[model samples]
Target: MNSFLSNAKRSCGEFLSSFKISQSTILHMVLGNNSCDLDSCVSAIVLAWFRSQMKNGNEVYVPVVNIERKQFRTRTEIAYLLDHLNIDSRNIICIDEANVRELSNVGKGFFHLTLVDHHVLLKSIEYLQTYVKEIIDHRPQLIELPSRIKCNISLVGSCSTLVAEEMLKNKAFSVPSVVETLLLATILIDTSNLSVDVGKSTPRDEAVVKQLSGKRTKDELNLLFRSVADAKFSVSGLTTEEIILKDPKWIENSLETIMMSTLHLDVREFFAREDSIDVIRNYCATHNLLAWVALAPVINQFKPIALYCEDDEVREKIIEKLIVSDLLLVKTSDEDHARSDVKFLRMYNCKNTRKQVLPLINEVLQQRSSNLSA
Candidate 1:
């Protein structure tokens, strides 16, 4: 086992063990988002380490949020990265491993949490609502918790960049070389190696890398990114359901449950697979998923494609409004395959990522609901 990983495992075990000793103790859990993407996972681990070092005697553990030990296999890139650093998945503690309800039973002020990667808490994990202590995220701030907590929300390529900055500024313990590599890989992949065309990255991202890798060149970062990306985009053994589930963000509205899936693979190739469509439909049916929104990176030149499931009247109405409201949504060329709820359309404005498109879809759904109520 790697020294860093062994140390991490020992710390996590000690943290969990401390929580069991008493109901009067304050146990701080640094948790990532449900997506469990590269950025979220990295931010949780690195920030938790930094915080634990600062806390001196507090109980702090970083738990991989919303994912089980076995489910780590679904996140191929995460697995590959951990494996590269000689970190064993078994050493890490998953969300399911700890009894959340048991934490709630431990009494007030006994359990505290610090969120990384996401500002808002999922409905499923609302049990931890009163326990939130701090939040560090890169996305726009959504909700403000009542407690006096440190909130670091910035517009960076990756949340990990913000975490790295904190570590550097605090003059925290010297970051290991392997840990530096881990942080750099996340930023490179998330920002597409700081490509301006993607527009997700900023100068801070590059500056951070330069600081972390004083003598290293851009080529080395690119090489590391390619290695990680190759692992991320590999879908040889993953079924279509697994592909959809990987890096999925779930949204629960008053009406229904929706899953927004983001993929790094070629959209055209995914659409061509009939089995893929079946898998999505079957999974949706089994899980009672009201809708599924699929977005992929630009593939086939400037042709960007977006897919959505509109099997019923409500979903169809949402889709209709989405097309009408979205200037980027080019409905001129769309194909609804027979017997499949999924439909694919070419996005003329490739810049509107899932982040931009999601709001439009939600707006449409909201408007439709208002009309029905009126």
Candidate 2:
């Protein structure tokens, strides 16, 4: 067994043991966001490990948000990362593996939930807000969490950067080599290795990488980023629906639900596949989504493209919102990039991410809902 993972599992066992005894069970559940992106997963695992090292004698379990064991393969990058680090998923607890409703029934007060990666509580598990003990995130502070909860919300590119700070402050850097590699790789992938033009990373992210990056230069780390990007973009055998699930983001409110997928493949190459539209429509229908958005970077040029499908009025409204995003991107057309239900808008300067788009999407939904209510 890998030394770090074995030690991680030992903590899991101790955490699980507390659940067996209902009388004085104190379960410290560290959860990543529902998106379960690479940053979320790594932050949850690493932070839980650090907590265990604190020797609180209480149980600490890190649950991989919504990714079930069966759906694990859809997250190719995460799979690549864990496999590369010699971490076994069998030893970890996933949301599907544990009965969440049962866990909730155990009394929210009994569980101490520490959130990593996401600031807002997902609607699906909003009930757990009462149990939240701390929040460590990179996104803006959108919600008013409990005053007692330890909130470390910031605007860094990666939440893993914050977790790295905790590890360093706690003097828990004695973790195994594989763990170190995973932490460093996560920061790189999330921040594009601290690229200034991308403007996603902060000085803190760069400092954390420098502290953790031993014997590796910035150029060498760029090489690591390329390898990680290759792993992230490798979606050859996956079905179009599976591709949609790969890095999807969901924006929902009281009145609407929008499902958006961000693809690393070139927009042209993705639609060149015959069944892309058909599968996208199928996913939208299955989920009863009001709008479906796809964002991809053009091949080689790295230009951005945003694609969408839904009712014509709603579609046009979304396009208008994006146009005003001030991304300084032009809108070009490609019939091949469109189908009966899908429309593609090419972008010149591609700095926009789903993080920016989510708010725009929610605004449109809010307006539509308000109009109807009026």
Candidate 3:
């Protein structure tokens, strides 16, 4: 056997021995196709830990969610790791069964199942409540899983990072350099390179990033950031609507629409030249959109100042009510925040800001419902 494979096998044996679980019954369910950076990270970390414990004859199954094609990368990496260890790829299972009845009947034996996922599975939760062995995830709902099943959930960048830390803590195995780099790259990609707009990058993610990069230079971090940014869908090929849908937050139904305008500026460019407020005003007019808001990051303060138009009349009212000198009217267009927006919204309760803007969204929704009824 090659040195790498040999080392991997040895680590697997050591991990299994430490756990005291019978090798034949431990089945790993690697949750694939996570949209959020944190979910993907957790998936990778847990899979790596499981890889270390897998014996030659042991069976490990990776199930892909049918709905999330974007999560294919996690499964692909797991396959590669298995191949490197000289394990057959056939053992990996792609789960297509949409219902729990089918999943529960797949196989029977001395089995301990581990599931890592972000989606809410009400049926699966009930099933797991009765029979699940363990689950590691970032979702808050998983807290209700029976105590008999081990559960780990955190609101951090990625679950993979958490899993990696746990493995290291238990002295399971040293993170291979390639694996370390991959994990760090995922974090930077997901967290937008620790942009302050995203929630503050956790110390764990920072430590891992530094370790992977081997040096803390701006140039190196920038290169990694560029690499991840490139992975995003190209602007030319996708419509603004498609791009907005790609946001993980959008998937949760918290937002009705998003509008954004970009401005390029040089050192000499004045805030007036940016015309961000005016551009937003024009967008609102053209689209006849309500509940429109604009966010510009104040990098020094690490907070996003959201400027929104209440309904046209309301905007006028608010401007009049507050007697604000600077007020701009605009239509709603659809655009989303890059990485920093994810962090900013979550960190600053940007969603709750809707309480003030709710009137517009409600008005829009009501109008739509009326139109449909007509």
Off by over 4 Å in 1: 1-25, 302-311, 324-329, 335-340, 365-374
lDDT of 2 by residue, 337-372 (tens): 566567766666656677777787788988888888
Q: Work out the TM-score per prediction.
A: 0.88, 0.90, 0.49
State which candidate, 1 or 3, has the greater TM-score.
1
User: Sort by lDDT, best first: what order?
Assistant: 2, 1, 3
Q: Which parts of model 3 are misplaced by more than 4 Å? A: 1-26, 32-101, 107-112, 117-119, 122-131, 139-143, 170-172, 215-218, 233-245, 249-374
Better candidate number, 1 or 2, judged by TM-score: 2
Model 2 weakest lDDT span, ten residues long: 1-10
| Clashes per model (N, Cα, C within 3 A) | 0, 1, 16
Q: Pick the candidate with the highest lDDT.
A: 2
lDDT accuracy of residue 185 in candidate 3: 55
2 or 3, greater by lDDT = 2
Give the CA lDDT, 0 to 100, for residue 152 in model 2: 95
lDDT score, residue 79, model 2?
79
Q: What digit string (tens of lDDT, one per residue) describes model 1 on residues 176-277?
A: 787798899999988888888877889899888888886678788778899999999888788777788787887665556677888757776776777877
Q: Could you give me the TM-score of model 3 versus the true structure? A: 0.49
Full-model lDDT, candidate 2 = 0.74
